[model samples]
Target chain A: MVTNEDAARLITAIKTSSTYDFTDYSDKSFCRRIEKILLDNNMDLNQLIHKIGKDKDFLEQMVKDITVNTTELFRNPEMWQTLRYHILPKFKKNRSIFIWHAGCSSGQEIYSMLILLNELGMFDQAKVFATDINTDMLEAAKAGQYKYRFNLGYLDNFDKVIKENPFNFEDKVDVPYEKYFDIDKVKDTIQMKPFLREKAVFRKHDLVKDGNVFYSKFDLIFCRNVIIYFNNKLQSRVIDMFNSSLNRDGYLILGSHESILGASANNFERSKGFYKKKQM
Target chain B: MNDYKAIMIGGSAGSFQVVSRIIAALPANYPLPILMCLHRLKHIRSGFVEALSIKSKLPIIEPHDKEPLKAGRIYLAPANYHMYIELGNRFSLSTEDVVNHSRPSIDLSFFSASYNFKKKLVGIILSGANKDGALGLKSVTDNGGLTIVQDPKECQVPTMTTASMNATKVDYVFSTKQIIDFLLKLA
Candidate 1:
């Protein structure tokens, strides 16, 4: 039950004590995350603040815990469907397709993208880059292992996006899960196949502070379900960064419900299910 | 009552028609922003806002993430997301795991609104089958905000109201008509 004042105190402590800056995060959700942290650790605000000030390792863990890492393969099948059928086909002309998954939580999205790209026969030409503020998440993204039973539901989503053609329902492809992942029911693990795992270059990058790490512009940027944690000011700043990082006529695919707003909205034109960078 | 910044309503199950009636009674120029976190089918995203807007004078919207909160508008929690009202009076949507088996969780919404608005908030619990809003309404009470529940006898499903009454010392337990009349007085 951390109050707003208490959350402010913790934020200030983190800012002064570490390089991690949560100042511009959406306060309500951030505060709720802090509350959850305290409850999980069974510690009060004062003790948590003390730990944050003194222990660097503890602070890193806190940052990882605070950043919501919930994601799944083909989480929104409809968005993936649009990407598979409409968006990726446009990039067929490009010799190299550069895809960036900003905030690639637990790597499900990275695998989802790779699976789509591979199915389209564009895997060889695609350069995939993934970045997250949490190093633990980056490591998890690298490992590419998820709980089998926990993610069984998302397998249906994979089938929806990869197998079933919505435009032509009768035209279905029998794509086996073994092609992309090795599901071990005995071990309760769904390990992503090495080909899909190796495609993404996982890196530690902060969306709030870190500007475009890749000097080269991208064909598409996926920053799904990540910007929702940010306040309007921060969202605009990140959106502006995405605008500059994208190549002309490139796409910026946000989460299903996410939309670019404020001044940054001018840079993107809403395409089928994505925000396309307007040719300036 | 005029000093209240926003009104948060939490409902589930047999609460939609009651909510429709209540919002229909609010004026076009209603001074307070109404935040409704009704439990909805996670996949059906579009029609809820349209259905709610049919009889309401104010524009009903499923606010985009980080959209600024405004007066005279009805903000419904988007499907498959938890909506939070931030300290700076802006909407923040989250796709975190669902709470109480609901994505647009009533408890989570009320928790944020209560924290953000503090004593200047008004929280009302309508007819529901679940106990999600009980803890949230209690949060409003704990934060010194006004708390109301639809009179359980008048509710289609009394579990939510009954749970809310047990959760905290609610300020009022009003019937649908009384609740609407009370909100009208605020305007």
Candidate 2:
């Protein structure tokens, strides 16, 4: 059993020696991830800490694994509805738009935004910067490929949640199974369309180290469903970064269950799923 | 009225039918709050709340962050998030790693209520494939709260109910109809 003191020491050592910071994340969740990492690497707690103390690659892999990048497209339909109805109207006055999708795992959400923008007829005018620490996921996102099983379900959900007309049968949509995928009958490989491939740029960026990317102010930022892994302090710091990154009156969207209320409540106003930067 | 403050229901696998039946049986004026944690796939769209709401006599909604826990209403767990009650009539949501491979794990909510409500909590464990609610029911019983389990013979999936039976002497081992009657008697 790794004591809290041991975890705290490891966190302190990593912050001073390396760029990653795990000190402020939820203790229970962070400890659980660490336990899993130790089990996967077949290391006892002491050995794992010692290995992390010396090995840079091992440390990087551990940070990436423990980051908790799991998210689904439009995980909460109501939040997206809130964004469409309440938040998007504010952006109508802007001539151009910038969006930063941090921790954009597998790019389903980036594509979801692209589709939303397309529906809003703003896709051509928007520039989206999508980044994640996982290079493999970024590559997959860039390739615009996903398993067929996920696509079937996503298509069903997209039609219901986004299209909002369950009566319009999915078969009526010209989503030529081919348009969305390149299917291999024998090998069972399916490649998805690189949705908004031209308008979006994919990059590998760590939120902990590359904290300065927010220098270019954006009109909207969607960092949904990613912060549950961070400790309270890191959550506060990242919310600060998000606050700073937005231009005046810009919107920040978060996971439905997440709230900046307790930690960063004063910085933004709650509107549906968004926290709008208080006018300076 | 007895201090029947809040009720927590736990189920897995064949829970949808049981949940629907319970909600349908409740009167519109049912005065206590009800919270449910049902195990389902993380990715699939859930119509559990909607389906139940249509059949239910009381108001039903998903719990929002810091949303006050009000009486005369039912709140179902949103898919893929853990829902727990806070100290003072509020809800807390967390994407904390899964326990027993379930995010809206029954154990988390039951344990939280057991600690917070003591005898004021009423726990019911229904149909499930695994023993997710055994420890949770135990927690409720040990904490002086009331515990109920679906009769194994009546359950579509008996593993979870059987586990609860083997682990502790649950207050009630009733069928879905009998469970509704039991709740009505308490109400």
Candidate number with greatest lDDT: 1
Q: lDDT tens string, model 1, A162-256?
A: 99999999989999999999999999999999888778888899888999988789999999999989877899999999989999779999987
- Let me know the TM-score candidate 1 reaches against the reference structure: 0.92
C-alpha RMSD of candidate 1: 2.3
Highest-scoring model, DockQ: 1
Q: Model 1 misses residue A227 by how many Å?
A: 2.0
Each model's DockQ score: 0.71, 0.23
Q: Candidate 1's residue-wise lDDT over B37-78, tens digit each?
A: 998865566688889889999999888887789999999888
**Candidate 2: Cα lDDT at A79:** 66
Candidate 2 runs further than 4 Å off: A1-17, A77-94, A133-136, A161-190, A203-214, A231-234, A266-269, B1-8, B13-35, B40-47, B50-61, B64-75, B84-103, B107-123, B135-148, B165-187
Q: Per-prediction TM-score, chain A only?
A: 0.98, 0.84
TM-score of each predicted structure versus truth:
0.92, 0.75
TM-scores, chain B, all models: 0.97, 0.95
- Name the weakest run of 10 consecutive residues (lDDT summed) in model 1 chain A: A1-10
